[model samples]
Target: MAEIQEKADSGKGGKKRAKKMSVHLDMTPMVDLAFLLLTFFMLTTTFSKPQTMEINMPVKPDSEEDQSPLKASNAFTIILGDDDKVYYYYGLVEDKPELNTTDYSANGIRKVLISPRIKSNDKMVVLIKPMDVSRYKNVVDILDEMKITDTKKYALVDINDADKELVASKTGG
Candidate 1:
């Protein structure tokens, strides 16, 4: 009986002196997850290029009674046909402008006018009025023409108020 009690006390003391096991988490998987998320965001991010020009549009007039005027020297109205053709007219919007006959010939519309009013400094504002069935290519071509013609200042006119039939009658495809 004394041997059994001595064995029991020794076993209890040995159990009390045993070292405890500690748990540690591995950080490799967490680091890998962070790198993967960073790569995904880098691949999905979009970069933007700056615009070439700074265009300022005119504000709308207060009342129908008031006729706000646009500068004649810096204005043009471009007409596009359904068959991918272009025509241009220039002057003040308030003055009911007319296009020069020499500007357009058998070849196509001319680039830049040599008139007393139009100079290098004076920017021509272009207003495009496209036909209903006009091709997108035609519009682009007209814009390119505007760029080529030294007519940097331009805008697209809404066809809702424009004469649609006149726009449809431009020559050549």
Candidate 2:
């Protein structure tokens, strides 16, 4: 708000002189506008909540070693390799078990994870083995797939010698 107040020719030699004026500015509307903008931003903006994934880790045995062993029949092994290559097989690599190749797509790993065999077996466990040549993104992708499939039982284990030999025989490395 603005206003101009005129003083009635306050000069001693008042010979048809112009009126002296002073301007007054009110800041109430500016403050109201600021508050309105603040409230609008506060109400419309979305606050980010801290998101965390629940990781199930095996507990260390105090007296004896880990007694409960993972069942072989319900194991689903996934191997990540170079050039975004993904391989998988059911159970252990028993002298060159067919290493099926798949990608990190909806039709690739997702379909395999949500297959009928996996869904039917309630105790199905996923074993993710990332090779030295594979990128960290591959492991993250597999973990995300596990989350998508609602899988509770899974492990990130190192590649064994038998697995390496099987892979070498298949890839002719």
Residue-level lDDT of model 1, residues 12-47, one tens digit each, is: 434465444444556787889999999999999997
Off by over 4 Å in 1: 1-69, 92-96, 99-107, 110-123, 165-173
TM-score for each of the candidates: 0.44, 0.71
Each model's Cα RMSD: 11.9, 3.6
- What TM-score does structure 1 among the candidates reach? 0.44
| lDDT by residue for model 2 (18-46), tens | 67789999999999999999999999999
lDDT of each: 0.57, 0.86
Evaluate candidate 1 by giving its C-alpha RMSD to the native, one decimal. Answer: 11.9
Judge candidate 2 at residue 172 and give its lDDT. 86
